[model samples]
Target chain A: MSPRLFRSRPARVVPAVIVAIVILAIAAALGWVAIAAIATGGSGDSALSSGFSGFASLGAMTWGAPPVITAAVIIALLGLILLVIGISPGAKRNIGYRTEAPEHIERFEVILPTSALASLAAAAADSVDGVSSVRAASNASSTIVTFSTPVRDNDGIRRDVDAAVTQRFASIAFNRTPTVKVRVQRRQA
Target chain B: MRRMAAGANRTGLIIVGLISLGAGFAALAISFGLAATAAPGLSPDAQLQPIAAVFALPFSAGIALVAALILAMIGVRWLAVQVPRKDSAKPLRMQEDSRSGVTTVTANVVAAAVEDDLEATPEVVDAQAILRGTARRPELILHVDVDERADFDTVVADIAERVACNCSQALGVPLSAVGVEIGIARSRQRRQRSVQL
Candidate 1:
C-alpha cells in the first residue's frame, strides 16, 4: 500500500503487519527444519544444524528468482512494521463508557417498573453537594448528568459518581457498576 | 511522570499483548505442520510431498492468520475502553472554605466568648445569640424563659443589660447592633443549640 496510509493512521495497519511478521518467522523456521530433515533422510540433528547454518550463510542457498523476491518482500514488510511500532511509543484512550442494561424487571411480581435503574442513578447523583443536575440516557439503565457547577472535569466529578452509583444501586437486584458520566455545565449565577 | 503514565494508557499496553500473542500462535501453527510432515502417511502427493507442505504452509497461510488475529485483539481492547466514559453523572466533591485548623465549624468563635460574660446577670435565666445579617455582626436574640408569674419586661431588661456589658468589656462589638429578642418560655431540656448574642 501507499506510505501515506500507514503514516496518517498507524493504529490501523501496525497490528496487522506485526501479526504478518510473526506468521512469516514461524513458517520460515518450520520450512527450513522440515526441508533439511527430508534431504538428510530423517536425521533430526543434521536438519537442526543446517537450519541455523543456512541463515548464517544467507546467499549460499540457491533458490528460484521468484522465491528469492518473495523472501525480500516479506523481510521489507517486517521492517516497516517494526518501524511503525517503535515510533508509536504508547496508546491513546478516548473518553467515555457504554453499557446496556435490561429493559424491564419482574421483581416479586412488581412487573414493568417505569422507574428504572437510570432514574435512581440520577436521583443519587442529584444528592451530591457540587452536583447541579443529572440527565440519564433515553435508555433508563444508562445515566448521563449535567453538572451545573463542576469542581474539576474528571477528578472531582468522577469520584462523586463512583460513590453515588454505589449508594443508589445498593438496593436493586439490577446489580451492576453503572457507568457515571459528568459533563460540566453552567447555571444562572 | 504521572502524565506520561496516563498517556501510555490502556491502548498501548493492549498493543504489546497482541504482538506477544501473535508470535505465540504463529510458532504453534508452524510446529503442528512440521509434526504432520515427519510422518509420511499423511502426505497427499508423492513428489510435492508432506515435507513441502511443512516448508510452505506456515509462510503462505499460518503467518497471515496470526497477524489478522492480532489486529482483532486491538479492536477488542478499543471497544472495552469506550463503555465507561459515556455513563457519568453528578458527583460529590469537597473544598476548604477556610483553613484555620478546623475541618468544620457550626458556631462563631467571637459570639461564643461574649455569651460567657452574660452569666453574671441574676435575672437573665437563659440566653442565646447568633451572628446575623450580611456583615455577620453578632446580634443578641436572647431567650429569657420566665415562669408564668414573673414579669416578662423585667427579665428581658436584665438580659439586655448583660449583653451590653459583655459587648463593651469583652467582645468590643458595638452595643447598638446587639438586638435581643425573647424566644420561647420553654425549659432547656427540649432545646437545641443556643448561643447568646
Candidate 2:
C-alpha cells in the first residue's frame, strides 16, 4: 500500500477540470454548428441556421456595448485567478527531523506532521508533576502548550512543564527547533 | 504519497489563463477604443460584421473542425490525468548473476516485511512502507504511528539503526535513501498477547 508520508499542496484539479469541461463544451458546440452549416450548404432552413445567425448578429454589437464589456471583465478576472493558482507555492506541511545516518546510507529524511508534534508536546507536558492535563498546538516554527493543574502554586509547575516539554522536543532533534511556549491554567474545584 | 499530475495541471492552467487573459484584454482594448489607432476599422462603434463574414466562407467550417478536434483532445487528456496513481516500482532482481538461479522480490513483499519489522518496535502502533528504486540502490519510504507517551528519539534511532540496517543486510545492498514520517496515536489499540518479565 502507498503511504502519504508528506502533506501535499492543492493540485488545483477543480479549476483544471472545470476549464477542461468548458473547453470540451465549446468544442462540441463549435463542431456541431460547423458540421451542420457545411452539410446544409449554409442554407437558412437548416436547424443550425439560428446558431449561425446568432454568431453573425454578434458582429452588429458595438465593442462599447455593456454586455461585451461585462463579459470581458469576467473573463479577465477568471484568468487572473487561474494565474494566481498556478503561481502560488501553497503552505508547508511537514516538520523535518535531524538525521545522522551511517556511511553506507546515501540519503535519509525524517518528518513529523504538526499534529503529531503537538501531541508529543501535550504528552510531555502532561507527564510533568502537578499538571492535571495538557493541550498543545504546533506549527512549523513553534509549539504552544497549555496546562491545567489543581495546584495553587503555579510557578513551579509552570517551570517544570516548560522544561519537560522543551526537553522532550530537544530530544527529538528536529532540523529546526520550534520555540516552546507554556501556559498554565488553574483547574476549578 | 500517491502520484498526481500536479505539474501538468499547473502548466495547463497557465496556458489557459494566458489565452483567456489575451482574449479578454483584446476585447476590452477594442471596446475602449484603445486599439482604434492600430486599426481604424476596429473602432468601438464598428460592427462585428467584417469579422463574422470570415465564418461565412467555405474554409471556415474546416478551420472550426480542426480547432474543435484539438480542443477535444486537450480536454480528454486533462480529464484522464485527474486520477491518482501509486507509481510503485516493478519487481526487483536481487541476485547478482542471472546465469545461476535468479532471485526476484516484489516491492509489495519488501514493504510488508518492513511494516512488520516497524510494528515490532516497542512504541510503534502502526506502520506502512513502500519500497522503491532498483535492488542495488533501494529506497524505503515509511509512515509510522507511535504512542504519544513513547520516546520519540529512541523509536527513530531504532528505525535507522536496526530496522533499516536489517533490511539492507537482507537485500545484500546499502539503502540509497530512507524517508520516515512519524505520527502520534493517542490511544493504544494493539492487544498484548505476552508480557515481558
| Top model number, lDDT | 2
Instruction: Return the DockQ of model 1.
Output: 0.02
Give the TM-score (vs. native) of candidate 2.
Answer: 0.77
Candidate 1, residues B29-67, lDDT tens digits: the string is 333343246564322222222333343332333333344
- lDDT against the true structure, each candidate: 0.39, 0.83
Which candidate comes out best when scored by TM-score? 2
List of clashing residue pairs for candidate 2: A59-B48
* Candidate 1 structure quality by residue, lDDT tens digits, A26-140: 5555555545544554433233333333443333322223444355455545544544554554332111112121111111011111223344455566567676666654232
Error of 1 at A71 (Å): 60
Error of 1 at B77 (Å): 52
Interface RMSD of each: 23.4, 3.5
Docking class of 2: acceptable
